[model samples]
Every structure is written in C-alpha cells, then in structure tokens.
Target: MAEILNLVGSKIRDYRKAKGLSQDQLAELCGFHFSYIGGVERGERNISLENLAKIAETLKVEPKVFFDFNHSFVQPPSDKKEAALQEVLTLLQAKELRHIQMTKKLLMEIFKTFPRQ
Candidate 1:
C-alpha cells in the first residue's frame, strides 16, 4: 500500500542519515540517478528489484532491511562490542556524559601508570 511505502521511505531516510550517506552518494552506489533516490525517499516512486539489490548491497544489509520498519533500536548481538558501547553511551545524560569523559580520563591515567609487566 502507499502508506506502507511511505513508512519504508521514512525508515530508509533514517538509516541513510544514521549511516552518514547523502542521497547522491547512495544513488551513485546503487547506480541510479540522484532524482531516483530523492523520489524513493519521498515515496513518490517505487524501486525496481535491481535497484533494491544494489541498495541492499551498498547499505551492507539484506534487501528485507528496507521493509523491517521497526523504530525501536535493534541491539547488536551479545558478541558485538558496538552494542556494549551503545549501552554505555545511552546511560549518559549531558552531565553524565561529562562524568563519563572524566572517568575515561582517569582510566587512561591509571593505565599509563603501569609499564610493560
């Protein structure tokens, strides 16, 4: 349905921003025109299978990632360092973030106290 496509569009735009990719960059990687990316993002155009494949490959995710429009953050597996880092980062308020910075500095200083032993 058109509404579904718009939801997909917004999700794609969110992922695109999170990945720090511009529409032009994504379009180039997918071998499409910049307008095509814009149209897709605007939900004014439906993408073809080939475009979907190219986009999936360039985005480093499966084609179905485009359709999995969950707004909830998908935590990485327990084995992934990034998930742990994300957890740590999310614990911070602005003041807490400042404390985190100072904690990191203290840890760095503590580590520097030891020589190779």
Candidate 2:
C-alpha cells in the first residue's frame, strides 16, 4: 500500500541522514542516479529489487534491514545457531569459495562498465 511505501521512504531518509550520506553519495555508492535516490526517499517512484539490493549493499546491511520498522539489525546469532552455521560455513571447500569470490569480482567489474540510467 501507499502507506508502506511512504514508511519505507521515511526510514531510508532517516537512516541515510543518520549516516551522513547525501543522496548523491548514496547513489554513487549504489551506482544509481541521484534522482533515483531522491525519488525513492520521497516515495515518488517504485523501486526495483535489484536497485533495492544495491542500496542495501551500499548501506552495508541486508535488504530486510531496510524494511524493518525499527531499522535495527537482527541480533547476532545465539550460540547454538552460531556454532552450527559456522561449522557449515567452515566445511565449504576453500577452493569453491575462492572461485565464487572471483566470479563475483568479475561480474562486478563487468557490470560497472555498463551504462547507468
């Protein structure tokens, strides 16, 4: 609903201001147009998933982070879940993770060369 979008926009503006990020600066970090950031903050434009993801990444947070009314991150995992997730992550082959990292780097570079609207 329009009210939800308005809330999201308000939250974005508040968080951005708290972090001392200008619309231009945040847009640059997300590789977006400054106008787009302004529109988003004003709830005047519909945001796309990709752009939302990019904004979240640039803000160094998860996408769900932006939607939360409190604007706070999920607390660090409890001991049990932390241990299990750590074990799982640790068991992932180093070489496979390295390959994934390399692929991500390559894709970022390739995308940077594309035109931005």
Q: Best-fitting candidate, measured by TM-score?
A: 1
The per-residue C-alpha lDDT of model 1 at residue 67 equals 81
Model 1 misplacement above 4 A: 71-79, 84-117
Number of clashes found in candidate 1: 0
lDDT of each structure?
Answer: 0.73, 0.74
Model 1 local distance difference test score: 0.73
Task: Look at candidate 1 and tell me the lDDT of residue 81.
Answer: 86
TM-scores across all candidates? Answer: 0.60, 0.56
Estimate, for each residue in 1-117, the C-alpha lDDT of model 1 and write its tens digit.
787767667766766776679999998888888888888878888877788777778877677767865434353334668777766655543346679889789979999989968
Model 2 bad stretches (over 4 Å): 70-117
lDDT tens digits by residue: candidate 2, 1-117 = 777777777767766776779999998888888798899988887888888888877766667756877433323344898877765454543448687688679879999999997
Cα distance off (Å), candidate 1, residue 99:
33
**What RMSD does model 2 have?**
16.8
Q: Compare the candidates by lDDT and give the number of the best one.
A: 2
